[model samples]
Target: MIEIKNLCHSLGGKLILNDINLTLPEGSIMGLVGINGAGKTTLLRLISGVYSADEGEIFCDGLPIGDEKARERLFFLPDDPYFTGHTTGKALFELYRVFYPDIDRKVFLEYMSEFKLDEKKPIRNFSKGMRRQLYIALALSVKPKYLLLDEAFDGLDPLARLSFKRAINQAAEEYGTTVIISSHSLRELEDFCDSYALIDKMTIASSGDIAERVNRYCKFQLAFFEDFSEQIFFGLPVISLEKTGRFARIVLEGKEDDMKKALEKLSPAIVEQMPMDFEEMFIREVEGRGYKV
Candidate 1:
């Protein structure tokens, strides 16, 4: 497991992250979601030991992250990966092997073949998507204990994204790789992540199993028999509500059975369960945080 306790950091007098605390266990895929300047990248950098934690302790499997050996078990792929001007994909693998002595050359070659990425061309000439693929290949080849990826799904089409996510799941199941990926795509994140953590205002706003958090709220649509005061439904246990003519769509903060019982008492003409997607929940959570969602 990885533990980040009271993590804090700043750059040039600007607070990039503050008092961030998180616990990530092994053998799980976590989605790190946040807005552009919410410090998702900064938190990943701190956990990977690229940027030192200004205040707090970072531990990996009971080993202090300050030790070089502990850091060796972690791999971080930034938004824009750095490589030598003329370095080829094959050469990149060799360079990585110098640091990650147990690099899986076979796996690297297999990924290259799967992605159809050329290994002899200069990295400088590779397209943005191609470079992203190469970085993914390298990250998997190293087989680190913990993997951190920033904007991992950028520069990829739908087919490629599907293939990438499938490969990640395969690797996690087969090799027990603890992976944390940061992405703006909620739909994509929802597909692969079993757990999640949200960052807002330099602090962790929420974190937990994705399914559990989503289960806490229920959505319903009701068409009243006649014109009635909309305030009748207010504060019954609602996260938010929208009204259209006689129909009202609401998100209730409780279980399906209890909510159903309560709504039955209202005796609406048409009552049905409404769909609640993750984006809507995210908006509500952020709004409660006093921000414009």
Candidate 2:
């Protein structure tokens, strides 16, 4: 398990994150999400020990994150992983082996083959997606207990994205690896992550099971025989409302039955509840904070 308590950090005299706390159990996948510069990457860097916190502490499996033993159990994959122009895929594996002595050559080769990458080819010759594939193979081969990936799905086509998801899922299931991935692709994250943390205004605005969080918001489409002003929904817990003529679509925050009952009071000819996905939930969340989304 990973524990972050009262974590605070700053750069260039400006505070980036403040008083953040989070707990991630073993073998769980979490999506780290936020608007640009919301400190998502900064938080991940702190947890991975690339940058020490200015306050508080971080722990991994009861060991302080600054400890060598704790660091050995985690792998941090940045959005732009470093590789020299002359480095080959096989050479990259060797480089990782220097730090991770137990790195599995067989696993590396297997994943490389699966990803259709040439081990002997210089990394400079590979495309962005291919380099990402190579590094993912290395990550799996390292077999770290904690995996941190930033912008994990960037530069990948649909097919590559599927392959990457499959590899990550297999690793988590077989090795009980704890995974935290940061990405702008909320739709993909929705399908892949079991839980999520939303970072906003230099802190975690919300964090929990994705399904439960999404379930809290109910969406409905209504039609009325006569035109009605939008103020008719004044008392209801409306997150967003779009009205045109006698038809309106709305999202409300509450139990499904309760929200339906409240909307029924407005006497609409049609009151149809609709499914709310994670992307919609995220949009509503930020919008609630006065963001024009």
State the lDDT of candidate 1 residue by residue for 1-293, as single tens digits. 89999989998889988898899989889999877799999899888888888898889988888788888989999999988898999998988889999999899989988888888889899888889999999999898888899999999778778878988898798889999999988889888898999999899989999888888888998999887677887558878778888888878889988997888788899889977766667777777778765
Candidate 2 off by > 4 Å: none
The 10-residue segment of model 2 with minimum total lDDT is 90-99
Candidate 2, 122-190: lDDT as tens digits = 999999999999999999999999999999999988998998999899999999889999999999999
- Candidate 1 yields a Cα-based lDDT of 0.87
**TM-score of candidate 2 on Cα atoms, chains taken together:** 0.98
TM of each candidate vs. truth: 0.94, 0.98
- For model 1, how many clashes? 0
Candidate 1 regions with alpha-carbon error over 4 angstroms:
none
